[model samples]
Target: MTHDLLVIGGGINGCAIAREAALLGLSVLLVERDDLASHTSSASTKLIHGGLRYLEQYEFRLVREALGERERMLAIAPHLVHPLTFVLPHDHAVRPWWLVRAGLWLYDALGFDSSLPRSRSLRRDDTGYQTPLRQAYRGFVYSDAWVDDARLTVLNAVDAADHGAEILTRTGFELAEQAGDHWRVTLSDGRTLEARAIVVAAGGWTTQAMTAMGVPPRGKLRLVRGSHIVVPELFEGDHAYILQQPDRRIVFAIPYPGGTMLGTTDVAVEDPSDARISPEETQYLCDAANRYFRRQVSPAEVVSDWSGIRALYDDGAGSAAEVTRDYVLELHDKGAPVLGVFGGKITTARALAEDALGRLAPVLGFDAHPVSRARVLPGAMIADIETLARQVAERWPFLDPHDIDRMARAYGSRLIELLDGVDSVRDLGRALPGGMTEREARFLHETEFARAADDVLDRRTKLGLGMSEEERRAFADWWATAFPAG
Candidate 1:
């Protein structure tokens, strides 16, 4: 069957664009080389916030657009995206207190209609707040939102499939050429498909995919590597810390489910696949965190480390940190139109998708209708997380409160669907180390496109952090037996 669009890549942008196009009554076929969000999309800092530092670079338009999308995501996916407060302690040696205050004020102004509280100043003796800072005279607390990045991408794909789009994971796009008005495409599995238009949202692999498809390179992309380390809890507050380094870069210490997530060094690399954290990068993150918190962290305390590559549109910036995070779409409409996506952040992915669809509408001979703005994602039927958790606990009183909460946070209103007819713990099947049951694993495989054990333990849910090495091995063995590879 000939489709209206052939979307390559399964990252946030690719999935989002596929959903948008399908909603606009276009047939879309999205093919991913690996599992959805297995690359840069899942390896994000997982915050939905206006890049505060971007204000320094005078990126007002990008910050404002991101702030608008942040509010929309909170409204749509409350369970996965919730408010997070950030405490930025003043460090006069790095950035002055006045400059930081001004930046915070500007950020608040951008999100004036935000449901979250505006930025507030805090004294050193603020109650219920403690930090290990040497000189914590004052600090500013502002609002942002945290997200389960991988789940967000997966839900978009699920929604797209529900709208009649075909999602083909582990299927690579091999080649393409203009055939009449449509593009004849070749897949890695030797299947052929045709589409009137194509979208390349391959994240870090954008340039490579474009070149391989014979589409002339539009511009240069700087592959910037950002790494993070998960260590023991650094502080005792629900709020996270954003530290300003001497080099004018910012590192965040977020309170993750199992521990503190410290990160993100900006280093330029030649290849996108070379996204592993180096020893120097780990030490650098530890030193950045130690500068703020009284309790010092070392590389030895790191439990796990991850890294991702960002394909920033190279605009001749001297430093990787200074490169623009804003995305640019290049359209080649010589025959069968191909839209190429460049640098973008997770917070603004939906907007990027909308813009991408709008640009490709005329070429594909369809009127683009904006539908995602009013529609909820696959599991985001409910708007309030607390209310959903309460209802789940009431229905399944036998289940542990912690388990119910985790399930609700992960699946949202779909938790009810997962627990349908399951009145007892045994009915949910054998319990795993992190409270995950065989029933949920089966659901993930069937509905969320989960194939491997890591797809369940790591991306779909972060239960792997709490499991022992032996537990992980046992779970993998059980999964292999329960659902063997074809």
Candidate 2:
């Protein structure tokens, strides 16, 4: 059947756009080549934050808009996104205290609801409670939110489905041709769809998607690969850290999936499909993690690592970090109208969706009514996280408090639904090593359109990060039984 809008890409931006449009009563079809959120969307630093580091680049407007979106996400999807505090330790080698204070102050002042505590200076003696490395530094605590980036994308897709959008994962748009002023799109799976307008929200493939439609690429998407390493828990609390290595580039050591998540080296790549972190990048990340933490991280200690490429808008910047994180849309009237997306971050995806629809309003001949601002994505909208935690505790009485805490933080009110009619942790089904469970796998597969083992264990969940080879293989074997490739 022909749809009003066909959105290519199941990343956050695509899912969000589809969700927003479908909720506005548009007939939308979202197609993804792989499992939903398996690309750059899931491979994020996992922060739903206004990038404080972007301040150095004078991206105040982007930072402010992102900060506003963070608050809205925290409110709308209280389950998937919530407030996270970051302790910016003042190193003598880095920027001075006053300069740091000014940045932090601006970070706090950039127009966001103050549900979280305001920025504060902490003494060195008091800062040791936050981290083990407590030498030659003061601390400044500020707010940013953490998110289950993959789940956020999936939930948006789910909501879109609830609003009548057809979501097709493992089905890719292979080609597009004009048919009487409309577009006839061929899917890689041998399916064809007709749509009056199309939005190419394909994260890293924006250029290629547009080029296939016989349109010359206007703005280039600079593919920058970022990698993360997971290690054993290195002291905890919800507080995360931003570390500036000796090379002046910053790395984040975040609290993720019950372990310390260390990350993110920026290396430019010509091909997004070929992007992955190299051995040198791994060593660089470990060295950066070792610099701040008292416990040194060796390569052997890296349990697992994952990489994702960021689609940055090329503004002729020499360095990946210097490239703008903002997004741009190019509309091609050639054949059918193709609105191509380039370069966006997770924090601003919702706004990006609205902006994209606004841009397409004139072309589609249908004004997209405003939506998604006051709306809550699926599995969010919990009245209170504390009350939801209590419900989860009652439902899984035998589960470890720490594991339950992780579930509650990640799933919010949906923890009860996920654990529905199940008593004790065993009812949640087979436990792979590192807290991996069969029930969680089934949930992702049944609800979120997860078709592969890695989609379940790696991106949809972080169990792969902590799983041993034996454990990963076991999960893979079980997953193959459940979902063999077609």
Best model per lDDT: 1
- Total clashing pairs for each candidate: 1, 0
lDDT of candidate 1 at residue 207, scale 0 to 100: 88
> Which stretch of 10 consecutive residues in model 2 shows the poorest summed lDDT?
127-136
The C-alpha stretches of model 2 lying farther than 4 A from their native spots are: 127-131, 395-406, 419-440, 483-486
* Per-prediction TM-score: 0.98, 0.92
As a whole number from 0 to 100, the lDDT of residue 386 in candidate 2 is 72
- lDDT for predicted candidate 1 compared with the true structure: 0.89
Model 1 lDDT per residue over 189-290, tens place: 999989899999998788888888778767889999999999898877788888889999999999887789997999999998998999999999999988
lDDT of 2 by residue, 1-486 (tens): 889899999999999999988987889999999888888888889898888888988999999999999988988998788778777777768777788899888988995465778889866566444446645567687888898899899889989998899999989889998887789989998988899889998888888887887775788778899999877776567678888767668888887654688889898888888657788988998888777787778777876678899988888988887888888888877557888888989999999999988888877777776788988877675777777677666766677777777677666666777888886666778875568678877877887778887787776666676677887788788988877772
True-vs-predicted CA distance for residue 238, candidate 2, Å = 2.6
Model 1: lowest-lDDT 10 consecutive positions: 128-137
> On a 0 to 100 scale, what is the lDDT of residue 205 in model 1?
85
